[model samples]
Target chain A: MSVREEQSQPAPVEGGSSEEFETERASATPKGGEGCDGCDHRATKPRRKSRLPALNPPLETTQHWFIEAITHPGTIESGMRKAQKIVGRGRVVTDGPILDAVDRMRIYHYAYRARLVECLADDYPTIQYAMGADRFERLASDVIDALPSRKANLNGYGRVVIDYLQRGPGEDGGRVPNRRFYADLARLEWALVEAVHAAPVPALDLPALQAIPIEQWGDVRFTPSASLRILRFDYPVNRFLQHFREDKVPSIPRAKTTATAVYRQGFAVWRMDLDLNMVDLLDALLRGETLGAALAPLEDRLDASHVMAWFMAWVRSGFFATVR
Target chain B: MSARLGFPDLGIGIGLRTPHYRHILDERPKIGWFEILSENYMQTEGRPMMILDQIAERYPIVMHGVSMSIGSTDPLDTEYLRELVRLRDRVGARWVSDHLCWTGVHTHNSHDLLPMPLTEEALAHVADRVRAVQDLLGAPFILENPSTYVEFAGSTMPEWEFLSRLCENTGCGLLLDVNNVYVSSRNHGFHPHVYLDALPMDRVVQFHVAGHTDNGDHCVDTHIGPVIKPVWQLLRYAWKKGANASILLEWDAEIPSFDEVRADALRARRYLS
Candidate 1:
């Protein structure tokens, strides 16, 4: 099969669920709900706790001025305000005469704001590319305002767009409730990201699994492979991500499928079609169960050779690490 | 980095980023030493750490970090230091270093190298922290001076004097960022040469040259471009001061071709050599 076609379909693995499939629903627990809609978009952040007690700050000069410029990012006396010369993104179009800290800061703040916005554009570019600039401009602005810089580099930024889509970090409609379809797309993108840096896992040893006998097949439980992840979404993010990877514009795809096993084979991480039982089986295994222990709950009647063959196939496919 | 890296002698070299990894493996560029980002290799285990090992076999490596946030008032991130010391021993790093800027406070990391005001009280505070870190690491840690876009109105000494006092009190060497000096000089209206000249030259163990954005009023150290001419001039002046500190060229953003980076290294070598 060709590469695209080969990748288009999820790999078939043994031990898939026999029953009907369902996605894991968000369990309603009132405890510490990620208060998404509580924030008003207009946020006053926590006050600055005492720093290393002002090292070389200008005496009488509240370090707050510079901190405000760096964090809040707009205002002339606050670097961003003075910097008129084309800072990175936010605010208006500019020309020159960005002469000092105030101008530089204004521009820097613009640039800084611009950098934050641009990273999202790059990250969800498929979304931006698909959604058009108009929607993207509005949504991107809100996303930027809601998320704050936490890491040294922009690598980990926008990680919360998925969380925001589910529930807000604070209060108010952080576009989380409104953007349901984004979860799948985010999952798809996140899967690709995981694949990019996923740690290497050793392939399965079929013989070791085959060593178990037919009589004990029903008791054969398995541990989740280190490469394994189960992802379920209501949207066709797999297809959307596939298209996006090829530089195609982000457009919606057809009917939703149930959960799939996202696993790494060699250096590549990919999704394989799976049934409900398989997802639960792997989930059980990941929780640290022995093959006998994990399969004990399945309680499915199985012929000796068939069970043995199934376990053998899973091991050959590089699934399951160690049993509890 | 033409001259050697002090007493233990870290030999001469450059920062081993991915771009130069292949080239260094192939051509094996010459210099005194190299500094790697500490946290980058701090994972429980990975290929990044593996590459560090492979590279360390061929050259000396020092640990430089952005996440240490030493100047932070956040009760000394001991967990981070433990990992740092572990990675240092793992790679056998020559020394551990970070900027004097506070990255974040109260466990919230802003991730920017913030500028600290130069004051006696601030200086003393940082010095105490430096001593604490040194005691933990059991090695002399160098603190680099960060570039500033704004100056505090509080009464204080110049940037150089504060850095000098830091070294005098803490026994920490300076990782003098020449480009930062040049950028901050232009932004705050101070002379880059004077800034370098004011610091006690003997205490400077390393020099950093990188690209900065010339945003009219202030030159911000964005580390995106090739070294500017003025910074090169300042480096030439610094070299004239008679200290042979290892020089590191930082080009983090908009990274260019490996050839272009190597060429930039060659250019830096021209001045220092």
Candidate 2:
């Protein structure tokens, strides 16, 4: 009566171990001083006279200029110039005994982009792996500049990568191969992260369902788990994610629309492909439809036995939290 | 029995990094305490919170944050402050600490601990914010000296003097990171002793010892490898000067097993003796 009998294998549950998350966070360290997206442009431009800001500007002005300089999307000198143009002057940092002020300022500039890039990489590991480090670093650098982080928590920062990818190619536009595929992959990966962080809710069990009167079963509406994410993608990114997690070389399949169900069960996050019947049924149920109303659309696709089996599988998977 | 403001000297502790959660939970190693990155646990009610709930039940916890941005010109994030207090009560943490530098301004966060301009105006601004934060927490808020690569042209005093004045002005406690002192001294060409000599040591309730990446021209607070020899020496110097505070090792990058990291944190005990 379980879905395992209906599939080649049981739905795969990716272990969201703390070690895995720790490794993701540890990899977010600064990638040294390569500057931002187009750091190579710095070599061609000649160094200008130091335009350090006047001593002791207002704290607000200094913070504004410093934030502008470090996040300027270019070389440290260029960042300083950009900030100076905005502030009507330059020269905020004093030179150290060994390094010049610009060189010293570059540390913050490199770290700002590096931290954000690593955060994006952490959230979208499959994309980072597929794009390779250098290209991914470049894309991440551009995405960071395009979308500045406004929240105190970094967990929500990577949500913008999906929006950025969907906006078409970036500064190095055409170099981003298969934009739609990458966007879909980012969506799946972000969903996985969200599932890992989603709040825990008590799941409804068979006994609880049986506790309802038989006559009232038709009107029993089910509430989906808060961690449950039902995604419809243009590409089979779920299979690709499985392969990636297995440490196998994941190939980008040609565009084919697919539906996926990602949710956390206990400590592990599970990803399963959904057939048309399950997708429609679950979609209806998620919309607060009662059991009878939800199954009505699937009547042509599923028989009584099939419907009962699917309900058993979903209850076993902890997909629904409560029934009313 | 305790350091300043009734906060105990919990002896040697390590940062409660995500990598060591399982080991700490399963084996429940005998460590003095744990310093959690408050931002990591904030705004999430999932597995991390579950794990923290378990860990908090077993050990003494201190909440260390990175996003307070106390030195910024923007109004304090009252929401963040409220969540911080809630988290402290939930975990029963000993004290809450964050860096003295601002992270960003005007609603945009750089996420990097950018250095503060050590001017009189900046000092006054930070002191007022510190008072407000401490008042909100209804406890003595602790601030740590951050590692800086560049000094401000308008700085009226050295970093230690700024910290001393702020502690005097706000009645706040100090975390007094020895490694940050070492890193900043190396980066800005100041004697480490001179930096330590000026600090109000009794105000120091905690010490942070971490490894940094020495890029020759400057040292970045990468918190990577082992605590270097001179950094250990600096800890000894500060401890001798009456900083009876809890000591913690911060290993955020390439962290080893709990045994290795705990061993590294325990290394502080030798200097204390």
Per-candidate TM-score against the hidden true structure: 0.76, 0.93
| Pairs that collide, model 2 | A51-A91, A52-A90, A52-A91, A53-A90, A53-A91, A53-A92
Stretches of model 2 off by over 4 angstroms after superposition: A1-10, A15-54, A168-175, B1-3
DockQ of each: 0.23, 0.55
CA lDDT, every model vs. true structure: 0.58, 0.82
lDDT of candidate 2 over B1-273, digit per residue (tens): 235767888888988987788888889999999999888787777777888999999999999988898998889999999999999999999999999899889988998788899988898999999999999889999999998878888788999999999988988999989999998898889999999999988898999998888765567787888999999999999999999888999988777899998888888878878
Tens-digit per-residue lDDT, A73-103, candidate 2: 8687787887885556556778777766787
